[model samples]
Target: MLRLPKYLWFVRMKVNKIVELKTLYSFEAPVFDAHGTAGTSQSAELKNKLDLNSYLAPFPGETYLVKVSGESMINEGIYDGDILVVNKRDRPVDGKVVIASLNGEMAVKTYRDIHGVIYLFSANDKFLPIEIKPFWEFEIQGVVKHVIHAV
Candidate 1:
Protein backbone atom coordinates (compact mmCIF):
# COMPACT_ATOMS: atom_id res chain seq x y z
CA MET A 1 0.00 0.00 0.00
CA LEU A 2 1.19 3.55 -0.83
CA ARG A 3 0.21 6.67 1.04
CA LEU A 4 1.36 10.29 1.04
CA PRO A 5 0.49 13.86 1.81
CA LYS A 6 -2.58 15.57 0.41
CA TYR A 7 -2.28 15.85 -3.38
CA LEU A 8 1.10 14.04 -3.32
CA TRP A 9 1.98 11.49 -5.97
CA PHE A 10 1.26 7.89 -5.18
CA VAL A 11 4.27 5.61 -5.33
CA ARG A 12 2.77 2.31 -6.29
CA MET A 13 4.43 -0.51 -4.42
CA LYS A 14 1.92 -3.33 -4.89
CA VAL A 15 0.40 -2.64 -8.28
CA ASN A 16 3.05 -4.50 -10.21
CA LYS A 17 4.88 -1.27 -10.78
CA ILE A 18 8.63 -0.81 -10.85
CA VAL A 19 10.29 1.56 -8.45
CA GLU A 20 13.87 2.77 -8.91
CA LEU A 21 15.99 4.32 -6.17
CA LYS A 22 18.83 5.89 -8.11
CA THR A 23 19.85 6.62 -11.65
CA LEU A 24 22.93 5.49 -13.56
CA TYR A 25 23.36 8.45 -15.85
CA SER A 26 26.51 10.48 -15.36
CA PHE A 27 28.10 13.47 -17.08
CA GLU A 28 31.28 15.36 -16.34
CA ALA A 29 30.67 19.09 -16.69
CA PRO A 30 33.15 21.88 -16.27
CA VAL A 31 32.57 24.22 -13.38
CA PHE A 32 33.29 27.89 -13.74
CA ASP A 33 34.47 30.16 -10.95
CA ALA A 34 31.56 31.50 -8.92
CA HIS A 35 29.07 30.48 -11.61
CA GLY A 36 30.46 33.22 -13.82
CA THR A 37 31.14 33.13 -17.53
CA ALA A 38 34.13 30.97 -18.23
CA GLY A 39 34.71 32.10 -21.80
CA THR A 40 35.49 35.76 -21.21
CA SER A 41 35.57 36.93 -17.60
CA GLN A 42 38.98 36.37 -16.08
CA SER A 43 37.62 36.47 -12.53
CA ALA A 44 35.29 33.56 -13.27
CA GLU A 45 37.19 31.82 -16.07
CA LEU A 46 39.00 29.26 -13.93
CA LYS A 47 37.66 25.86 -14.80
CA ASN A 48 37.35 23.16 -12.18
CA LYS A 49 36.32 19.58 -12.73
CA LEU A 50 34.27 17.56 -10.28
CA ASP A 51 31.90 14.63 -10.31
CA LEU A 52 28.24 14.66 -9.31
CA ASN A 53 28.95 11.95 -6.80
CA SER A 54 30.69 14.44 -4.52
CA TYR A 55 27.38 15.98 -3.53
CA LEU A 56 24.99 13.15 -4.23
CA ALA A 57 27.00 10.45 -2.58
CA PRO A 58 28.34 12.02 0.57
CA PHE A 59 27.05 8.86 2.27
CA PRO A 60 26.68 6.34 -0.50
CA GLY A 61 23.51 4.25 -0.49
CA GLU A 62 22.11 6.22 2.40
CA THR A 63 20.16 8.62 0.25
CA TYR A 64 16.84 7.97 -1.43
CA LEU A 65 14.68 9.97 -3.78
CA VAL A 66 11.12 10.96 -3.06
CA LYS A 67 8.79 12.86 -5.34
CA VAL A 68 7.11 15.84 -3.76
CA SER A 69 3.59 17.21 -4.22
CA GLY A 70 1.16 19.84 -2.92
CA GLU A 71 1.69 23.59 -2.45
CA SER A 72 2.20 23.54 1.25
CA MET A 73 5.89 24.14 0.72
CA ILE A 74 5.78 26.65 -2.12
CA ASN A 75 7.35 29.43 -0.12
CA GLU A 76 10.44 27.30 0.38
CA GLY A 77 10.68 26.62 -3.37
CA ILE A 78 9.36 23.08 -3.01
CA TYR A 79 6.54 22.45 -5.48
CA ASP A 80 4.53 19.66 -6.95
CA GLY A 81 6.56 17.30 -9.11
CA ASP A 82 9.84 18.27 -7.46
CA ILE A 83 12.17 15.42 -6.58
CA LEU A 84 13.49 15.49 -3.05
CA VAL A 85 16.82 14.00 -2.06
CA VAL A 86 16.18 12.44 1.31
CA ASN A 87 18.82 11.05 3.62
CA LYS A 88 17.18 8.59 5.93
CA ARG A 89 20.22 7.98 8.06
CA ASP A 90 20.81 11.64 8.79
CA ARG A 91 19.24 13.18 11.84
CA PRO A 92 17.28 16.39 11.30
CA VAL A 93 17.86 19.31 13.62
CA ASP A 94 15.40 22.10 14.28
CA GLY A 95 14.20 23.98 11.17
CA LYS A 96 15.17 21.25 8.77
CA VAL A 97 12.96 20.12 5.93
CA VAL A 98 11.96 16.53 6.39
CA ILE A 99 9.82 13.73 5.07
CA ALA A 100 7.62 12.34 7.76
CA SER A 101 4.73 9.99 8.33
CA LEU A 102 1.81 11.55 10.07
CA ASN A 103 -0.69 9.04 11.35
CA GLY A 104 0.36 6.58 8.64
CA GLU A 105 0.16 9.15 5.84
CA MET A 106 3.31 10.79 4.54
CA ALA A 107 4.02 14.52 4.59
CA VAL A 108 6.91 16.89 3.85
CA LYS A 109 7.35 19.85 6.13
CA THR A 110 9.78 21.93 8.08
CA TYR A 111 10.65 20.35 11.41
CA ARG A 112 10.66 22.79 14.27
CA ASP A 113 11.03 22.77 18.03
CA ILE A 114 10.06 25.57 20.36
CA HIS A 115 10.88 25.16 24.01
CA GLY A 116 10.89 21.41 23.64
CA VAL A 117 7.54 21.37 21.87
CA ILE A 118 7.89 19.98 18.38
CA TYR A 119 5.90 21.19 15.41
CA LEU A 120 5.70 20.81 11.66
CA PHE A 121 5.44 24.03 9.71
CA SER A 122 4.21 24.48 6.19
CA ALA A 123 5.94 26.99 3.95
CA ASN A 124 2.69 28.27 2.55
CA ASP A 125 0.33 30.51 4.42
CA LYS A 126 -2.71 28.54 3.41
CA PHE A 127 -1.61 25.68 5.62
CA LEU A 128 -1.31 25.76 9.35
CA PRO A 129 1.61 24.60 11.49
CA ILE A 130 0.98 21.14 12.80
CA GLU A 131 1.61 20.81 16.49
CA ILE A 132 2.69 17.49 17.88
CA LYS A 133 -0.34 15.52 18.82
CA PRO A 134 0.14 13.13 21.68
CA PHE A 135 -2.32 10.59 20.36
CA TRP A 136 -1.06 10.61 16.78
CA GLU A 137 1.73 8.55 15.33
CA PHE A 138 4.37 10.82 13.82
CA GLU A 139 7.79 9.73 12.66
CA ILE A 140 10.46 11.30 10.51
CA GLN A 141 11.21 9.23 7.46
CA GLY A 142 14.18 11.33 6.38
CA VAL A 143 15.70 14.78 6.08
CA VAL A 144 15.59 16.44 2.69
CA LYS A 145 19.06 17.43 1.59
CA HIS A 146 18.32 18.68 -1.89
CA VAL A 147 15.45 19.50 -4.22
CA ILE A 148 15.46 18.81 -7.94
CA HIS A 149 12.86 20.82 -9.77
CA ALA A 150 12.52 20.65 -13.52
CA VAL A 151 12.26 23.86 -15.42
Candidate 2:
Protein backbone atom coordinates (compact mmCIF):
# COMPACT_ATOMS: atom_id res chain seq x y z
CA MET A 1 0.00 0.00 0.00
CA LEU A 2 1.36 3.41 -0.97
CA ARG A 3 0.60 6.05 1.64
CA LEU A 4 1.27 9.75 1.16
CA PRO A 5 1.38 12.49 3.77
CA LYS A 6 -2.01 13.96 4.66
CA TYR A 7 -1.63 17.53 3.48
CA LEU A 8 1.45 17.73 1.36
CA TRP A 9 0.09 17.23 -2.18
CA PHE A 10 -3.02 19.44 -2.27
CA VAL A 11 -1.13 22.73 -2.23
CA ARG A 12 0.51 21.97 -5.57
CA MET A 13 -2.86 22.38 -7.24
CA LYS A 14 -3.36 25.88 -5.76
CA VAL A 15 -5.92 24.59 -3.27
CA ASN A 16 -5.27 26.43 -0.02
CA LYS A 17 -8.58 26.60 1.82
CA ILE A 18 -10.96 23.84 2.81
CA VAL A 19 -12.61 21.84 0.05
CA GLU A 20 -16.26 22.62 -0.24
CA LEU A 21 -19.34 20.56 -1.10
CA LYS A 22 -19.40 21.50 -4.78
CA THR A 23 -16.13 19.70 -5.37
CA LEU A 24 -16.93 16.34 -3.84
CA TYR A 25 -16.90 13.66 -6.50
CA SER A 26 -16.71 9.93 -6.50
CA PHE A 27 -13.48 8.30 -7.59
CA GLU A 28 -13.56 6.71 -11.04
CA ALA A 29 -12.96 3.01 -11.11
CA PRO A 30 -10.69 1.38 -13.65
CA VAL A 31 -12.45 -0.21 -16.59
CA PHE A 32 -11.91 -3.89 -17.07
CA ASP A 33 -11.99 -5.89 -20.28
CA ALA A 34 -15.46 -6.28 -21.67
CA HIS A 35 -14.93 -9.58 -23.48
CA GLY A 36 -11.85 -11.06 -21.89
CA THR A 37 -12.19 -14.68 -20.79
CA ALA A 38 -11.46 -15.56 -17.15
CA GLY A 39 -10.83 -19.25 -17.58
CA THR A 40 -7.58 -21.17 -18.14
CA SER A 41 -5.45 -18.94 -20.33
CA GLN A 42 -1.94 -20.18 -21.01
CA SER A 43 -1.78 -18.80 -24.52
CA ALA A 44 0.35 -15.86 -25.61
CA GLU A 45 -2.73 -14.12 -27.00
CA LEU A 46 -4.38 -14.02 -23.59
CA LYS A 47 -1.34 -12.38 -22.06
CA ASN A 48 -1.47 -9.53 -24.53
CA LYS A 49 -5.17 -8.94 -24.01
CA LEU A 50 -4.88 -8.67 -20.24
CA ASP A 51 -2.31 -5.90 -20.32
CA LEU A 52 -4.74 -3.16 -21.26
CA ASN A 53 -5.87 -2.21 -17.77
CA SER A 54 -6.32 1.43 -16.97
CA TYR A 55 -3.87 3.14 -14.66
CA LEU A 56 -6.67 5.32 -13.32
CA ALA A 57 -8.36 2.76 -11.14
CA PRO A 58 -9.86 3.84 -7.83
CA PHE A 59 -7.49 3.39 -4.92
CA PRO A 60 -7.48 -0.05 -3.35
CA GLY A 61 -9.16 -0.46 0.05
CA GLU A 62 -12.01 1.30 1.82
CA THR A 63 -12.13 5.08 1.70
CA TYR A 64 -14.72 7.78 2.25
CA LEU A 65 -15.28 11.17 0.65
CA VAL A 66 -16.31 13.57 3.42
CA LYS A 67 -17.22 17.17 2.83
CA VAL A 68 -16.30 19.69 5.49
CA SER A 69 -19.53 20.64 7.17
CA GLY A 70 -18.45 23.30 9.64
CA GLU A 71 -15.88 26.07 10.09
CA SER A 72 -14.78 25.30 13.60
CA MET A 73 -11.61 23.90 12.15
CA ILE A 74 -10.42 26.97 10.32
CA ASN A 75 -7.33 27.49 12.45
CA GLU A 76 -5.95 24.34 10.95
CA GLY A 77 -6.72 25.80 7.51
CA ILE A 78 -9.62 23.42 7.04
CA TYR A 79 -12.50 25.55 5.88
CA ASP A 80 -16.15 24.77 5.56
CA GLY A 81 -16.74 22.87 2.31
CA ASP A 82 -13.34 21.34 1.83
CA ILE A 83 -13.08 17.68 0.87
CA LEU A 84 -11.05 15.53 3.21
CA VAL A 85 -9.03 12.55 2.11
CA VAL A 86 -9.95 10.17 4.86
CA ASN A 87 -8.31 6.77 4.97
CA LYS A 88 -10.35 4.81 7.49
CA ARG A 89 -7.43 2.53 8.26
CA ASP A 90 -5.22 5.39 9.39
CA ARG A 91 -4.65 5.62 13.12
CA PRO A 92 -5.45 8.71 15.14
CA VAL A 93 -2.74 10.64 16.99
CA ASP A 94 -2.40 13.68 19.19
CA GLY A 95 -2.73 16.99 17.35
CA LYS A 96 -3.92 15.12 14.28
CA VAL A 97 -7.02 16.24 12.46
CA VAL A 98 -9.55 13.46 12.53
CA ILE A 99 -13.08 12.69 11.46
CA ALA A 100 -14.95 11.24 14.36
CA SER A 101 -18.40 9.98 15.25
CA LEU A 102 -19.63 10.96 18.65
CA ASN A 103 -22.70 9.17 19.85
CA GLY A 104 -23.61 8.83 16.18
CA GLU A 105 -22.97 12.39 15.02
CA MET A 106 -20.12 12.91 12.59
CA ALA A 107 -17.65 15.75 13.04
CA VAL A 108 -14.11 16.85 12.28
CA LYS A 109 -11.82 18.17 14.97
CA THR A 110 -8.23 18.29 16.07
CA TYR A 111 -7.40 15.85 18.83
CA ARG A 112 -5.46 17.23 21.79
CA ASP A 113 -4.34 15.81 25.08
CA ILE A 114 -4.41 18.00 28.17
CA HIS A 115 -3.61 16.47 31.52
CA GLY A 116 -4.70 13.04 30.45
CA VAL A 117 -7.99 14.40 29.17
CA ILE A 118 -8.64 14.25 25.46
CA TYR A 119 -9.94 17.49 24.04
CA LEU A 120 -11.46 17.91 20.62
CA PHE A 121 -10.47 21.44 19.71
CA SER A 122 -12.42 23.45 17.21
CA ALA A 123 -10.93 26.42 15.41
CA ASN A 124 -13.73 28.76 16.13
CA ASP A 125 -13.48 29.17 19.93
CA LYS A 126 -17.25 29.19 20.24
CA PHE A 127 -17.31 25.45 19.94
CA LEU A 128 -16.48 23.57 23.10
CA PRO A 129 -13.97 20.80 23.55
CA ILE A 130 -15.69 17.45 23.67
CA GLU A 131 -14.81 15.57 26.79
CA ILE A 132 -14.78 11.83 26.23
CA LYS A 133 -17.30 10.54 28.73
CA PRO A 134 -17.66 7.02 30.02
CA PHE A 135 -21.09 6.32 28.55
CA TRP A 136 -20.54 7.91 25.18
CA GLU A 137 -19.65 6.07 22.03
CA PHE A 138 -16.90 7.56 19.91
CA GLU A 139 -15.14 6.26 16.86
CA ILE A 140 -12.06 7.67 15.16
CA GLN A 141 -13.11 7.25 11.54
CA GLY A 142 -9.94 8.49 9.93
CA VAL A 143 -6.95 10.73 10.30
CA VAL A 144 -7.47 13.48 7.75
CA LYS A 145 -4.41 13.44 5.50
CA HIS A 146 -5.34 15.98 2.88
CA VAL A 147 -7.81 18.74 2.16
CA ILE A 148 -8.93 19.53 -1.38
CA HIS A 149 -10.37 22.91 -2.25
CA ALA A 150 -11.97 24.47 -5.29
CA VAL A 151 -10.05 26.96 -7.33
Q: What lDDT score belongs to each candidate, Candidate 1 first?
A: 0.70, 0.59
lDDT of 2: 0.59
lDDT of 2 by residue, 1-151 (tens): 2222244222111222322222234444443443545564543232222211122113324355567656677778888678777667778789998887665556788878778877667766656666666566777877776766886
**How big is the positional error of residue 142 in model 2, measured in Å on the Cα after superposition?**
0.7
TM-score of candidate 2 relative to the true fold = 0.58
Clashes of each: 0, 8
Model 2 clash pairs are 6-145, 18-82, 19-81, 19-82, 19-83, 20-81, 20-82, 72-123
Error of 1 at 142 (Å): 0.9
Q: Score residue 31 of candidate 1 by CA lDDT.
A: 80
State the local distance difference test value for candidate 1. 0.70
